[model samples]
Target: MVSCVALLGGSYDPVHAGHVALAALFADLLQPDQLRIVPAGDPWQKAPLQADAADRVAMLALAFEAARLPIVIDRQEIERHGPSYTIDTLKNVRATLGPGASLVFLMGADQLMQLDSWRDWHALFDYAHLGVAARPGYSLAAASLPPAVAAEITVRQGSLEQLRTTPSGRIYLAETLAVDISATQIRAALRDDDQASLAACSLIPPVVLDYIQQHHLYKN
Candidate 1:
């Protein structure tokens, strides 16, 4: 059997339950040899992160330490300088896994819609297969996809079997548990200490919450 590695990259300013749940779901679905949870070092497309790189990585480690899942907190993107681009990260991960290993790039449905805007977005398929998780109100079959992306989807889309076996060039849509949580909301709640907001932050793990409180993160 070919070894498969799934890469799920994000700012992970403070890894929350939604992130952990999605990672677990994907791991079960793909049965990859490893599921790497990557923290973005410097995301150019978005506003600057509230927490520092070390802090984000530390929280990620705490969040996944007892996940009972085959997950690893990958710090390559966190360690690298400058903006963190998906294509660049994929290239490095692909090379590390070699040509024989199947590399799966995991993303949410919303990210798929905006993929064309990413730097060298088209080249992403050349390095790894896309494993997109369905999000609320986002339809993978919608007509909003870019022509090139839609074309690639039509041709390269595959079943879980193909996704597990093929080394690259496939798009797999997975229905994962929608936790309806966002890091932005969590940060806002932590900063404001609003009762309602704090309640909504239940999606965050206890250990991670403790770490956040200990470090006084998001309390600007």
Candidate 2:
């Protein structure tokens, strides 16, 4: 059987339950040999991150402590200079894993909607297969996606087994994921007058909440 590695990359500003759920859901379905959590160092398209690299990485560790699969915290993007791009990350990962390993890059449907804006977006499939999870408001319907992204995914859609077995160039969509929390909302809540409101929301893990509080993070 081909070895499969699932990569979940994000800023992980505070590492919330939604992020953990996405990884857990895919881990159960793909049963990949390894799962890597990649925290972005400098996301080119987004505003500055509220939490620094170390804090974000630390939060990710705390959030994913209960994960069943072996988890790796990849800091290549953090160590790399300049803006972080998914294509560059995938190229480096592919080089490390060689040609036969199945590399699945996971993301939400919202990201898929803006897929065309990513640097070298079309070439991403050359290095890894995409495993996209559908969020609450985002639609996976052909009419809901950009023409290019919709056309590309239309032909590459495959089963969970195919995602686990294929080396690259396939798309697997998981439509049952109901997670809808956003890091922006979590950060805003952390900065609010009532910090307890964030805890009540249950958007982030308890351990992560502890870390944020202890670190005095996200205070403006």
Candidate 3:
């Protein structure tokens, strides 16, 4: 069987339950030889990150500590200054793992909707297969995606097995993810200490929540 490595990348400003769930879901399905969590250094598209890189990495460590899959916190993007781009990261990983290794880069459906806007988005397929997780209200249908992105995913969509066997250029859509959580909302709740909203959602991991409070994060 071909060796596979699954990568989950995000700002992970405070690593919440949804991030863990998305990673866990793919880990269960792909069962890749290795799982890596990539925290973005500077996400050009988003606002300035609330948590610093060290804090974000610390939170990721705590969040995925209990996960069943072996996890590696990849700091390539964080180490490289300037805007973090997926295509660049993918290229670096592909070079390190070599051509024979099957690499699947995971993302949420919301990211898929804006796929066309990423730098050299089309070249992403040249480096690794995409494993996108769908949440409530996010559709994988072509009509929901940008015309260019839809065209690519439409013809490249494949089963989990095929994604595992293929080296690159495949798309796997996993709709099993039902939790729809966002980092922006989590940050807002933390900033306000809105316990009621946080409790109602129950999407932030206790350990992560504790870490955030202990470090006095997002209290601006």
Winning candidate number (TM-score): 2
Please, what are the lDDT tens digits per residue for candidate 1 over residues 73-182? 77888888889998898888888778878889988888888888999987888899999888777777747677777887888889988878888889988765565677
Q: List the residue pairs that clash in candidate 2.
A: none
lDDT of 2 by residue, 26-124 (tens): 998999999988999899999988889998989888888888888899999999999999999999998988988999999999999999999999999
Error of 2 at 63 (Å): 0.8
Worst 10 residues of 3 by lDDT: 193-202
Q: Which stretches of candidate 2 lie over 4 Å from their true place?
A: 199-201
Q: Tens-digit lDDT track for model 3 on 1-220? A: 3389999999998788889898889889998988888999999999999899999999999988998967899999999989999999999988988898889999999999999899999999999999999988889888988999988987898888987877899999888898888888888777665568667336788888888889998889
Better of 2 and 3 by TM-score: 2
Each prediction's Cα lDDT score? Answer: 0.84, 0.90, 0.88
Candidate 3 residue 169 C-alpha distance from true site, Å? 0.5
Error of 1 at 167 (Å): 1.0
Error of 3 at 134 (Å): 0.9
lDDT of 2 at 128: 93
Q: What order do candidates take by lDDT, descending? A: 2, 3, 1
